[model samples]
Target: MKNTEVLEERITAQGCTEHLSAVEDAIYVIGGKWKLKIIIVLQENGNIRFNELQRNIPGISARVLSNELKDLELNGFVKRVVHAEQTPVVVEYISTDYSRTLQPVIMALSNWGKTHKRNIREDAF
Candidate 1:
């Protein structure tokens, strides 16, 4: 059987379409490493400039960040603003109303990760 067919069968067995859709949406948006990090940064800082975000997030190239931001903007999770000014003009990015909806989800994931890490460290003993 195909991968999607397997997934559909498993989803049906779970008996929760709502749960599956939520999981699917979460995966769709946070599938990439850069996307999750970018959302977290924007959540913490409110609005940030392009270079500032680049500096804050290590291992992300300008082109990669640009592409990620563009994707986020297209998906209604991020908004980009260009400042038209003389001498060293800037562009800033901020989370949108839709993005704010994910705040609780992000916090929950962060908390779970922290707890999991702590448990793993303890288990190493």
Candidate 2:
């Protein structure tokens, strides 16, 4: 089917719950181990290539990173740009306009994590 048809189908299917469910859906998009980390890294550093992402986020396997990046790109939160060059062509990942919707979600989670971390640290101390 065409892109417009798909979008219209989705809009028709989703109702008042769009806003509320969208927030939940956002979690599903960025909830993974590497996804949130990738977002945080990108938020700080701007666009990044595949290898750079894997390097910045230690302990994430190549396969896992590839899958996660693909998922992010598919979900409209991240975009993949392919540079048509010679060998070792550059591929960069950047956030999309739709991704701007994620900022408040990320900020809320950041605040929550900070508070939770402080509480845990204080308890340990």
Candidate 3:
């Protein structure tokens, strides 16, 4: 049998636990309500400062945003740059190269979400 076939058999025989584990790992990093929102915002607008992101997100508190930003930074999905040139200093967050790799996945999820919402609306009527 082909190598692909053998791997497929292993996955199938193992109840697809490996696939589930991979998905769970992704969720652990980006599962929160706000992580994807932050990612989407950064993707759409490029780099942004803390206050700017809070303003764009709407309904997110300073504390929560801070925590999420830290988490994203910790996970290597975002980079924080601090500019000390100004008196008060400037801080901005931008997506890492790794995060950019997720753009297609994000866009696909977004489109699927829109369709799901429409389906719900139609079903409700």
Best by TM-score: 3
Tens-digit per-residue lDDT, 58-88, candidate 3: 8999999999999999998889999999879
Best-to-worst ranking by lDDT:
3, 1, 2
Who wins the lDDT comparison?
Answer: 3
TM-score of 3: 0.86
Worst 10 residues of 1 by lDDT: 1-10
**What global local distance difference test value does model 2 have?**
0.80
TM-score head-to-head 1 vs 2, winner:
1
Residue pairs in collision within model 2: none
Against the unseen true structure, what C-alpha lDDT does each candidate score?
A: 0.86, 0.80, 0.89
Q: Which pairs clash in the backbone of model 1?
A: none
User: Against the true structure, candidate 3 has what lDDT?
Assistant: 0.89
Model 2 RMSD in Å is 10.9
Q: Rank the candidates by TM-score, best first.
A: 3, 1, 2
lDDT tens string, model 1, 30-92?
Answer: 778799899888988988999899999999999999999999999999999878784577788
Candidate 1: regions farther than 4 A off? 1-14, 85-88
